[model samples]
Target: MTVKDLATLTPSGYPAVSLLMPTHRTPPDNQQDPIRLRNLLTETRRRLEADESVPADVAAAVYDEIAEAAAHVDLRQVGEGLALFASPGQVHVRLLETPVHERVVVADTYEIRDVVADAARRHRYWALVLSEQPTRLWSGDGSTLVEVTTHGFPFTHEGPGGTQGLPRDYGQNPSAHRDERHRQFFRDIVTGLTQVDALDTRPVFVLGVERYLAFFSAEWTAAIAGTVPGNYDHSGPHDLHRILAPHLAAYQAFEQIAALEHLDVARGANRYAAGLPEVWQLARQGRGAHLLVEEDYHSAAWIHDDHLHPAEQQPTSAPAGTLVDDAVDDVVELVARQGGDVTFVGDGSLATDGRVALILRY
Candidate 1:
């Protein structure tokens, strides 16, 4: 889930079940994903049913929705982790390339820490290949690109659509009719992105020839990330990734440079908090305006007495105060939930102890 979608989330109904588990991409290991998912669902079902605050119907709806989502979990399509969030009738499923620590939290709100941190570290976007025969949409994360099959993607030009659907005017000029049909087809794609898949949000990056791009641009109103004007219609995921890699790198490089500049300005104003603990405190207080973190920085920490301390191993059961598996992810979540920006820079960008720094909103 992107931070943009996280901002729209709120605690709803009774128990908000957040089920996350590590998934494997290859054989032997991947075979157990379905069973593991079922186990998590079973646990979530038990917790929801036991909670008296949750009405029976509401509990059932949540379980059914979660189960329905679970059924669609294709191990072949998944990356390293699968996260599912369910509250009453609402449900959200996300696949992550980074391995997620398995946890079953039945709380008032969805556990979004790992999701936030992953989204920050792994750049995700949409790669749309425009074609009249069959326009395609792909989900891109870092160097990988996967085709999207749901929400009526891979849309094709259905000329006249035959008697089953609507019939076009046969009297119109052939070229003009084809042009209108193409424009209308592109418009339908826009409608799907904004209307049909309204909740599924991402920065769209278009890949197409000049002709189709012009057609799509003319019909689409929403802002796109950038366009690569070429014929990638026949390109597979690997080839498409190779072509998009340079573009993605350029985009990220520009963003990283801009973020470093922002951090420098914040430092000059004495409005930044360096190191994890200091940033943690400010972030917890909703004072984080922006967080700049080194990409590989991670620290296991114990949080007690409103303070954070470095830990060698994460405490399994928190009899102490609380066991923060990765305080860096926690800090990212805290800042993001507070409407703050987060940027992951090169691993050595921050020379601080925790390799993290926060620009205080204060």
Candidate 2:
């Protein structure tokens, strides 16, 4: 979708922009007053609301103007006043004024690790995480982080003796090590997702190396089925960003589609045989939402006024193809004339569960 289309989907609750400022330079002596900072923010907000096409240059000018007035304020202190805004229908933006540092710790030895596992059994539930090292699993139900001990690996050692003792064999099989690492990763991520307050019962999306992807897909499918019972359904093996993009897009599309008055069809048993009449009725009434046809079914009979109007008219000698093909063509024509969407499905797929599900307007 175009950016304009996306803008139309913006939610109503959140602010359009967030400003973040970190503590760095001292505010100008006179600008140290909170009132001054508040006034600057007020001015900026006013300008933004007034200009339909506010550019970066204009924004910079506003900042400079504020800085000039707050001459006594340390620029660093002003920076800390910057706020983060979570825009509607947009990726959250955080303004950072201070440098954030990450610390790394290398374990002296390979050991079993315990990680938390949180499983969502809902069709829309999904979770994603990015990490370089294997993390310990913790309980996602509000308990403290649990350290799951690993049982199948050994840590490298290099001390004053220059690693003199007999070296413990990590593992003979490379695949085994990969499997263990992934198992821990999945567990930890699920735990983290469960801790998220916004997520209800929904399917989760997991992204990682190919090996982890395969392992998690298989294990998660089974785990969810066993845990939540009948609420799991998903499609993925994509990167975190890829998975999220589609979800956001689908949400937007769903919102737009929901706004329009439309018909929906659910196929029932004997759709191939019994559906012909309903299909014809829907077409005749100009209320067909979409024509759903099973690829495996064959026929050539045209349907009109709820009755099969065979091209040959002679029921005794007509080719079997005439019965099905004509019916499909008739349905297609009817739906198109009425401006409806058509979706064809494989014979055995879920789409064909019913003969022909016709979504109707009435």
Measured by TM-score, the strongest candidate is: 1
lDDT of each structure? Answer: 0.81, 0.37
Please report, as a residue range, the 10-residue window in candidate 1 with the lowest summed lDDT: 159-168
Q: After superposition, how far is residue 5 of candidate 1 from its true place, in Å?
A: 1.8
How far residue 86's Cα lies from its native spot in candidate 1, in Å, is 1.4
TM-score for each of the candidates: 0.77, 0.25
Q: Candidate 2 has what TM-score?
A: 0.25
Cα error, residue 347 of model 1, in Å, equals 0.8
Cα lDDT tens digits for candidate 2, 1-362? 11112112232232343332333445354245455446546655565556556455554454444344444444442322233222323322222222212111111211101000000000123333223333222111111112223331111222221233322466545455545655655555444544441233333434345544554555443233111111112322232234455653454345334322232223222222226555666666777655555544434564333366545663543343234433554555456546654444445443433445466554
User: Which residue window of length 10 is worst by lDDT in model 2?
Assistant: 112-121
> Which tens-of-lDDT digit does each residue in 1-362 have in candidate 1?
46756644665666788999999989999899888988988998898889898889888888898889989978787888888888876888887777898878888888887777777788778889998657888888776787887777878776653123444567767666667777888888877666533666666788999988998999888887788999888989889888888778777877889988998998899999999878898888999999999888888788877888778543455456676789999888888888888889988878853588888887
Given candidate 1, what's the lDDT at residue 83?
A: 85
